[model samples]
Target chain A: MRRRLKSAVVAVPVAFVLASGCQKAAPPPPLASVVVASCAAIPAAPGDPAWDAVPEYVAVLIAQDLVEPRLLRLSTPEIRVRAVSDGSRMAFRLAWTDDTRDDLPGPAEFVDACAVQMPRVIEATVPAPQMGETGRPVDIVFWNAAWQATVDGRGDSIRDIHPYAAVDHYPFEAASLQPGSAPQQEMATRYAPARAVGNTMAGPRQSPVQDLSAEGPGTLSPVPDGHSTGAGRRTEAGWSVVIVRDLPQALTSQGDSQVAFAVWEGGHEEVGARKMRTAWIPLKLEVKP
Target chain B: MALAYNWQIGRSMSYWYPENRPKRQFAAVFDINKCIACQTCTLACKTTWTSGKGQEYMLWNNVESKPFGCYPLAWDLNLLQQLGAQQWRGKEYAGRTIFEAAEAGERVLGWRPADLDYAYPNVGEDDCTGRVDRGAALRAPHLNWFFYLARICNHCTYPACLASCPRGSIYKRPEDGIVLVDQSRCRGYRECVKACPYKKVFYNALTGTSEKCIACFPKIEQGLQPQCFVNCIGKIRLAGWLSPPERARADNPLDYLVHIRKVALPLLPQLGLEPNVYYIPPVHAPDEFLSQLFGPGVPAAICTYRKGPDDPDLAGLLGLFGSTDRVVPRWRREDDWVAALDEDGSQIVRVPLKEPVYIREAFDAQHQVTRTNCP
Candidate 1:
């Protein structure tokens, strides 16, 4: 009798599961869409009171495992996104939870970062979300925490990082050469080769955000004369950042488009292709009467 | 992926790009038996290239006592452990290379050293293998042994740093086969720093980019040896160009020692980077340990090195090391002397195979004084 009772107990759930399996599985819930609220002016800071009026769109992030040097683990699970546009400019606010704030790049350390990607040209069929497919380009606005710290008056000198470091002197600082002279500049360039070559990443930053374009994975390049502005603030929960860029041409006439997002946690040793990312989500512009 | 011939492994192996050899490869040979661990070469390289603000800890050239010493502590031990069993059959390596043993997503099997790993660059300096007893006396082939190993970027035929760079910023120069990181293009990803099996590539936090030994290309272009090679107090290093085995010319000093006599061997050939720098195995170290560190060529190399005195040609070639600051592309042994030749076959420098010796007369009649230290 006990055996029969046990069999009956197991058979009931099994039959129900089998009956449910026989029918077609329900489709997954649709991803959350973002609506860009029209504003008179775009706010440059994440903590601005003007951002409170915009609705939040929660984006679920997955591991970026599509290419070589992949992020097999997801450090950040999701992020809260908000967007605002004022005819000529667009600004996005992204907030996420993280316990450790990493902004310094040491020998073995990486910085926390985030980027927003959008298709350069809106077509009938959207480009592949893996940094966009070949022939179809994507515009990316990247913000780095270390760059933010630099913009906020944090020094990048070796002595600034290593307080106890002692050096006799750099050749560029020699008294023989006049300050800001051609010879002094040449000597300074010898020490900092990247800056001498005009590598934008190695130069002093005027803004924390960078404008980049990509055709596929590992093809990220800086867009010449790109003007983007951004600011980030640390809250009790984690990081909140605001990235401002030129409004896309498609959003003006199409009223609807797609956007993607990526986040990196410095404490997790994430950099380059190792990050948590989200696929394209529907974006709509609220039409004004 | 394409298969490239690695003579060290004695077989074609998988590489990221196809086989594209340079016009001529930069190569060097370090004679280990003569090294005195003076660290002069280290200082020479440091003061010349790595003295900048961001490169304080970077040693483009370093001399570490082997069996315990390593720059990024345990660099070889960690890679060997992860690579598992490395076997060999005669001259061919019967093992998987770093590229072959890579995981699904990675291009090479490697580990990134922590920041602290570089803190103690000379941790096990002068430490011997076996313990010395209370009354242990030194004898021939003494059990407790240690050798100083001087290292720099190998400028490998197939550089792991070049293969693993996602930005394609690190490149091997086609003219001289010297690998370098393009400063402007690097994004500080540090993939090269992590992928180099020898742990030679270093990351600069101040510049936010990776740097490594450029083999002193400016000097090389002028036909002068690198600072480290020229400044070696022990006269243990020789810089020259090396050709592939099929095209190796016996008149070339590097080819004569490496291909003809086989007196020097590449370090850890089983890892299969086909490193350009070769080391003549120490005579006193055990064969098993030496073979593991070098390759199956250790026994034959040691044998040939031991017979160096009897072989005048070999002896003359070794005497040419550290004889000049110029790069010797070709050489010839004429009678009692060896001549280093330039690329145009003109003699640059020459050294006698044996130093001229003189014994002072026990009694100098003219001075009327006796010599107390007569030989």
Candidate 2:
């Protein structure tokens, strides 16, 4: 009887071990790659479109500065990063070129003519993905070092201000044009009168040039008080505008004269003029008589 | 041991300009007449200096037409309108300028990101009417008149970019007077971009450094012209060195600059960025218009009186004024106009100007007309 009992204990322990072993372990899940979309598709970088919504977000840290975005040309072996869209997540790789911004000494500041690169990462988010689904891709971004910190208010120091503030802010009185006029007429009425009063030059037309280059030796004639006294001088070089006239609507449409008074008067020398002064406006005009 | 290595790196790092130091002296003289509207200067600059990821739009050097164009979207107009016209002198930029900023409390780095975006939009592109349609079809006359305006960093005697750099990343090279942004030291704050009235400084997203035109000193040192000057189809560009003191000279450079404007010659000087790029009045425009464009001094300067039926000055006019801006640099109105390197009181040393070999055409054009008469 004692021998039989010991054998039964051993058999019972063995059976318990076997039973536990028969239970199956969960199958290992599949590995997946992360994908990201472009900013156009998602407006924000992947992982969290609103991830940067918080002020503490790294992007906000960079974007807050009030500086114009510029390119940093570097000439070293760089990794090229092309931006690709995968919804909000975009994909990119670092690109390298031979350009560098390092300055070399000489009469002029010489810069190397090769492209450079910066490092960035790609991250994405999956709203309704199963446990191990592949997420969207993120677009590639590059680093620019020219960013300066932003200031909350207009700087107190004089140096931090623009020099031409006054002219830029010069007040403009909107012309209350006559009701239902043609687009051209409405524009002329709104701008022409104010311009005429501002230039302080006599005549219905504004001369294109101040001094007339004479084609022949003629005695200088004083213009009558209300009348402008110059004609188109045919210099061997070219024709110079001697008198400026603001022609009536009738003459301007005919295109008989070089001075298009009504048309020129339509635009004000306000903000547009300031922009004109700073930026390059490429305009080529030739008069065929 | 690590500290020692760091110290060694720091010691090796030296710079040409430092804060609170005396500013260096440098100047550039653009030959207004030589420029052609090919935009080779802009391309040369973009390819050589500003081509990078962030600087997709940045143009350290740009050519703009007068009377109707500007970069950074009318930078001067914004400020001018803010401050009504009033009495002012040099450096007395009243009211709000692009560089002006206010501190928010005691924050050491008054960092405000949103304000930066609006203050200076670099390389601000706008639609331009480059070629005006005076008429259309065979009967319609089209005037091909686009002015070439080559631009670069002004490196002002008193650089606004330097003054406004809160971290002091921007500096002017004392040796050659080139203003540069130190990318390594720069935290990408972009203060220089905001502060520069000319908006020459740009934020390069790739390097996070503000990039600008480097004056091509390497090529200059090698005794070669900058890419723009060398590649210019129209010999409109001249590269040379101008002494710094010229800015302080009692005879303002404008006297010479405006010389072209005074005789029905227009300079488009109202923006107040004090651009180094100047224009020699276009030949085809009328004198009264030119006078308006340039102001009132051209007629007197050119001796434009008619001598009977045969105009004497006509020949001189034709010779002096061509269909383009390729005028002799010396004849330009800058106070520092130097006839040659050896000339006394010359501000800038003249370098070799590689005139394009339109030798036959130029000679024929010059000879065809009387030396002083418009043919």
Candidate 3:
């Protein structure tokens, strides 16, 4: 069961533990803000043209694998985020440290993934950051390492993974219509049926970073929008990703909105409900003078 | 999960809860000799349930051409290979039952099959072991043999699905031992999928959850048969309450076929899950092959099915096939017909020893007479 923050008590136990005996109580979560520069100011390539104007907010997020928690830990739950929005588009650069690099999901195992969630609400009353509530939807940009590997042309094909495994024959892959055509995979013919069956093969040229929408738990679905874009590169520490989309209509010359974030370390076999997450945080936007 | 000594495997296996047996346990039997792989049962099941978005690849009930066919490609062959070979001494298994197969740190006894493995519904349909050993004489028209083995969730007496689910998301109904995955509670770990040797449990990618055949509880509660049971064109499937091993009934139809006559046996009984679905082995198939699939009941079941016409009691049981849509909990031999009764002694069916001379749907309830004074 997903427990929502009651607006009073949140996960501040770790913070409280560190600052005990000090006169001043634990400090509030750092605010993340950015100045929207001109579109020309942003570079074409990923991890390029560093913007010193964007304030990098290093904030801690409390994560627990409460859903049938076993060996996997919700560790390294901290993210350094910097945001910006040109007159036409919005963007955020996020970085987090993870020990082992997980780039495969296979006959062996899972890939690392990161996502950013926004309430999709332009103006008043922030929706519950726990992926939003009913009637309120959260638009998400999810970047999976496996999809990225496909983009980089580095992922192995199904046959490549299991050499000894024989695929003798697939009726769907057969040419010249056979006698009994079948309860056909009508849509599947468009894509290669052999690889199409698995979940990992998202789609061809279909963004490595997918746009999804969710309203509360179990209400997640891929949003049809292809406008949102993201790019990421793995460093020695972990991963640094840039998620960008059209600027929200609610954003005036200078305004702020709440956004939520989640990350999954696939090497630990984390997926679905097993993830590291953060509550609603402010993301300020401005057209820098 | 709990443990029980399954002497059939000479080891303890994950068993249903203690003292958890309901007033009556639901049992089923499929006469493989009658099935023609028509797929009516599959359609009936698919149309009734499992037609949703993520369920496109799922078949709650499936018919696989044996020897070279399996719905999830090689679900049976793969598991068997993983289990390797085990010796069977007469009636008991001398090797591991998955539970004992697990090494030091592993929690599960079986393997996790990737979703890609379950991609095609019938990977090798009707593909025979060989196109017949042509060198041999054509004296036997049936040479390279293949039989249709209809399968469904067995709703085992001890469900591996129930045991492997960490959050206790899977449960066996005490009323009928119908194994079910709690959709609301399932977090989609697919542990049940891995633990189930039969690969009956399926993971719904869309819902991010797991689902399985429910055994049609609503219909069962209403005294109607499951869709697969009533829709079977071959008239092979029978559903009713089976008596527990300790309280074996000599009169009940299920017990008559299983315990009393010993002509119908549980599929893979040595697996030790004690699958509730029983089968009368194919008569013409290789005894060694049938033995592996149905255990020591192979020769005996084949003998009884082949000479069914000679035995009055066996003939009476055979007459009940495709005759009724209600569950027959208890049955007895009457003067003219074999009377099958429900829990309250209501006559669900009465099949005569011989077909009527004028055949216009012989099981007409309006003209059917009930033995009101039957015990």
Candidate 4:
């Protein structure tokens, strides 16, 4: 509703021609690929000096052509990413501008999170960008701030987010007087398999990088040997997150693969399917000397 | 979501996932004829489950006087009335289920009850319709009739609450087939609250999440019955697991009562959720009223129940009501009786071959002499 046209706008391309005559600044290039430089040793953490070999890429908004478009959180347009590999392991550092630090998710709250996705099979006919196609699956290493807090030794207990929550009867706790005696509530401080029927509530697992394999939408399931991991920190203007994990099961040998990234802005109530992401980017591994 | 045949309702309804039988399901049956309208069961459930801060108005187990009562005001009276006008062909209820009514943005047969609807927990208690003159005698055929209808979540084989939740926070546990809310994942959208036609799911403002009856899973895990079933003073409630029609055994208490004897039927089977809670419709209630409430099965259920001593299965079925605190998983016919057995083959209860005759017989000389009145 608030706008100032500065001056009468000229019609069509003439406006751009005149604006170019003044020459303010050049627009950034479209995001295409993230170059993962093979390093002597992959950085175990984001701030490590060894990550400099990887070149930064401007991650533009994954918009216009979205398989499942969630008309929310389009504010954060471009993100900075750097990737590095050391033959056996891969890691990526992502930094995006976000004003608010949303680490704690309450009853109606959401938390900031990000994920890295790669085709389960190294190189095959392109799979659906939305997760993947059946038989042709995708490997995902997901990260969350809440889970990072847990990995940092400060348990992501419900009380940690909801300070006012007082629980007197948590029968599922390992420290309870009668633990393992009956079905129990999900305590913030502990993790217990949900007693919810069928496949409905199977999604509340709290591990940061619970490596998941998906073969299309709504078909995400946990995988064995999902040892993927990550850590996240909040900067003044945004968050700097680094995710590290060995190549997924299918990519055991050196070959060309595909990688994708998705970012969730918690301040905008973005969770689940309502986030931003890329379709797929080419990822190549160099041959051994 | 896809359309699948719900054999219990003998129709199709939208389901979010494929159907697979639980190894064991938590189920219950309530005999409305024997309910004394006591609040004991309600109190027992309240003290056990929904007595938390935001649960001031929550009654996970409520026994309301029907035809004139509902806790969330009318609950589903509007929906029932809407569904009532729908056509039924033979045993089929030809109408749109909540899933078919998807254009309206709800997956099941439901409507959002206004907040004011929940303001009063007891809206119509012991209310009757007709007003008679002071001198007029109370006629044999009363015009107004109401019955105590106790309710809890059905933990349905196909749950609308489970399908309605966009977040998929509601789930039915395969371990015991007890439907529950995962508080951690619930964003408090109230989709489950709106979609449960029974209006059993409640929204907790303090926790900013929805809550419902957990079926007393702790006690169930310990091989005990729920507090509501254990504390019923009228001895009219039976808690057990039901089997698919093909698998139901003649001796299992629930199987005999529901499938073999055909005396108990699921409430509103025409809605097609394949509800787990079954009810023995009040025998004296008008056929039209009972039929509408229990679906086309009423006449058969009542007829089977009234077959009396002639029907070999009647006594064993009738005797199982309120017989034990734990559900009998299986049964064995022992001569003239039925021994209800658990998973370990332990007898949980025994049903006699004949119904007990509590009336004083006119042929008895002691009764005739004591009364001093004979035909």
Candidate 5:
């Protein structure tokens, strides 16, 4: 059934437009569709050869200045998106330009990040792009540069962040308690309360991408037992990140979906709702016969 | 947005949420005139909480000398400059609050301090205003003056930090009104750190979460004062429950001092957070600066505070400060003894209204030696 839908998607015509004008040119018309090409296996990295075969959709980014705590300035002007699916899973490769690499979290510092948002349930009408409206929920896969750094061998320990920090001792590291013992784990949890409480943002990172679901603004929450996987690399001029998640079952039958993108430039102090974002873009899933 | 009544501003101001007051509000009164800047409270808080890896720079309780001193350097001056011309019409504030002054698409008018800002927690420590001339004589209201402003989380009635958090991770405890950040829910956004005018909310880099003075809720739950309050060397702090002005009781120490006696005032009341921590304005500081810091209540509060022995009720209530480690919900002055009481009207502690003075003879005839330091 999935293979049948793959061939059906290829039959759909691709609409591509090029703008040519004087010094002052009209803004390019919004990209008609983001084509999700089918492949034997979804790429796990942006540099993978399979992504090269996929069409790139350049989405214009606008500052999120529509609500309270909004971004007043635009930082990431545009993002290039490429996506592919391998029968059971879907992956997106996002690349954007950022001058500085901000991966360290500090008192006032924010980390560079990007997110791919899709409606939790596909319906006749697309959900609102602003994190979806009430009742209409969206699933978001958020990747952070700092988390990527942690996963890429940079230590998540305090000593790694503050090399000169001196400490007499931590009760959790006491000699009496055996390493990895229940008592030691309990003591460790006492000090790292956020980690003990299962805050995904705290503690060590297994993957850079976090799965979240939101009903509307201020409702973003981590999805339990999320299986998303991603990797991000810092290129000379910017960052390229690949995020993978299980393919939505509805796409196999409908062959159509919608996705939105948001980017945060840590150097520009962008985080939370203060980010550059795009409205919902049409997504077509290609099937292979 | 909802209109919440801020007693400090003496008006209903713009707030993100409706006025949902707690069952009981945690409050404290700091007698600024008595603070000697010993930093015992600072150390006490440090030793109790915030002693972890990423909390090296965190000071849940800090003492900064006013006029020239600031933790996170100029946490107040920066916001004050932005708020612009804080005006007062008697007890009513005529100026825009941080909420009202919020820019387009912003929750509160606030600024986040840079990482280096926390580097100089003791910047301008002990620095005084106006140079003392060569022949400057001792006088009431001295020319050069500075006071130690010991600060903790205000646990505000309308916390700007709580209002600005997009995740709703920060909340005011409906039981005691202690504002806190839910560690599990926080995504290290630091929106609270940027929105708090007092800069009490701190971002812990390692944990990737914001931490603040829990108001020592552990102790509060046990019916004891916070570590800072119990360890204060100056005996200038009194922790208690505060009732709203309309429901204020004369016997309630916080209400008596803040509402009835009006001897203690909230810091930067014009910002409109309705900060719970109250200060007895420094009696010697100039009115201009004091008024700006404590709102229009400065002169009156200082006046009432200076009426020292004459105002027995106020004097006795002050004597109750640091009299016990237990939280004082009710108090009374009977004859020469002032007593601190619990919620059920049982005495927690008591102290004499006046310290018994003793006069020692210069000649120690009994010991056959002269007492050099005695009068």
Candidate 6:
């Protein structure tokens, strides 16, 4: 029920509360201006991709508990993605729908994924840059269809394809690479674990000897909780390695800067669990007004 | 009114001890259907209780959408699967039952990684420090069949936080059944943080004390809803006093809380924390879809509800509709673990379910069907 309060009635009660509830009139406190950073100042790194293709067709892999793998174009169908990272925790929500909610039971059930499908291609405004900073944290939420396709104990089903998107962008420090956009095969491989998880339909089952080192500059550290550790450092090649429990806490800056590590209650165990990682690029601190 | 005056007359009264308790119980009915994912509840909690330093990541009131949701990132299912379907009948949260004790060969009461910051590292901060946004995307869908679980301290009937705390910093108030983390008395040993399966207890590095959702005692004491509820844009929440101990249903898990739709449920009752927060099943999705969101045995669980003609199981079907109803069901909702064993000696209530029978609507609209309570 929407209750639109009349101005007169609302004003009377609000005024009364202010007038009677005030124990004493207090002076206003000094104001503090939070410094705003510029996204333009931090340009993208070299060898960045240009938007030559207006609607770049990219294939993303989707993963869930257990289901077969498939690829969906990100362009034609709407690509929906969500990333949740509350410092200690991080995850991506991804979904999409076809021109018709044909497979949908109804609008409510149809609006979301209830069956397995392929990865989706989305038309996005990805900027050209080797890598640039956004002046804020960027949540990288990836949804793999396979992850969703897997069935639950109650045999609940989900759409096959997965989508990942960033919530917000912080500062991005791109690693220098040979001039070329990420190849379709390489991009697909990056999402191999998600594909595996969905294909197998086994929840959070990572191979014991899983090698998560290829994802980025990081080593997985096991927290007091059983979840895997997502702490690591980058080498000169920009490759990341997991931070061992016995590793020295402080790091020495390499070519650009040294990566520091902090752990929290969030962690995961899976071959693809290492896919979730947030990187901090090193920039020489310069004094500015 | 009389109880208020009586408490005022004796300001120093203590109700923490299990004995000498009243006959009332406290429960929370979370209309998963009404959760809008505004995060106003999450942030309201941050500003009120967890805004302190080191507690930055601690979301005492976190809302996670099912199917692909994870707080510390797929924490529970990952470990639970690893533990291989081994159910913890009593106080133990599912997973490897024994945690490593710093004292050699001496098993500590309860400790797990989900409670501490050292478990999950912030690769975003480490990689980009000031510039690292982790490049991760976080979103909550609207108008879809997603459920919003705004979690705080459950203030359990028998708190794991209280039992596991070596220093005894965590205590459940007898007066209103609100659980609190007494900062002044805490040593940051973090025993309570680990013991709590829900992972509500947190260690604030800046304050060097264990912190958690206080159940908003200050607001509760004033007869008002917590900040999260008052400021919730969706109006998907309801706040009220629960039944005190003696008045609670004999051996009925839901007797202590409000809004147990004979079919309403708790997540992973097998872990045995006796969580006070309860949920109404979202049945709009297919039975299979409902199971994934709720967990493995959801379909069978939903079938236990009795339905009548024209009843869409509105109370049972929450979360997905984006409507947070504060409605309570007529029949006493049962706890999932009521039939299981209680290992650690934590008191567990046993409420048996009627034969699994699903109540359907007399007229089935394409959008909804009636809920049937199992008789």
Give per-residue CA lDDT, model 3, range A116-229, as digits (tens): 888887667877776677999988888877666666775333443334445443434456545445534543332232124332223443456877787775566667545787
Error of 5 at A136 (Å): 2.1
lDDT of 3 by residue, B44-64 (tens): 987677655445667879998
Number of the top lDDT candidate: 5
Candidate 4 TM-score, true structure as reference: 0.60
In candidate 4, list every pair of residues with a backbone clash: A157-A188, A158-A188, A196-B173, A197-B172, A197-B173, B98-B107, B98-B108, B98-B109
Q: Model 6 Cα RMSD, Å?
A: 31.2
Which sequence of candidate numbers ranks them by lDDT, best first? Answer: 5, 1, 3, 4, 6, 2
lDDT (C-alpha) at residue A88 in model 5: 85
> How good is the docking of model 1, as DockQ?
0.46
Docking class of 2: incorrect
**Which has the better DockQ: candidate 3, or candidate 6?**
3
Question: Could you tell me how far off, in angstroms, the CA of residue B303 lies in candidate 4 after the best superposition?
Answer: 10
Cα lDDT tens digits, model 5, B145-206, are 88999999999999999999998999999999999999999988888998999999999888
- Candidates 1 and 4: which is better by DockQ? 1
Tell me how each candidate scores on DockQ against the true complex: 0.46, 0.01, 0.05, 0.04, 0.53, 0.01
- Native-to-model Cα distance after best TM-score fit, residue A163 in candidate 1, in Å: 2.8
Model 1 spans with C-alpha error above 4 angstroms: A1-31, A166-169, A174-182, B129-131, B134-142, B358-375
Better of 1 and 6 by DockQ: 1
* lDDT (Cα atoms) of all candidates against the true structure: 0.88, 0.33, 0.70, 0.70, 0.89, 0.36
C-alpha TM-score for every candidate: 0.90, 0.37, 0.61, 0.60, 0.91, 0.38
* TM-score computed on alpha carbons, candidate 1: 0.90
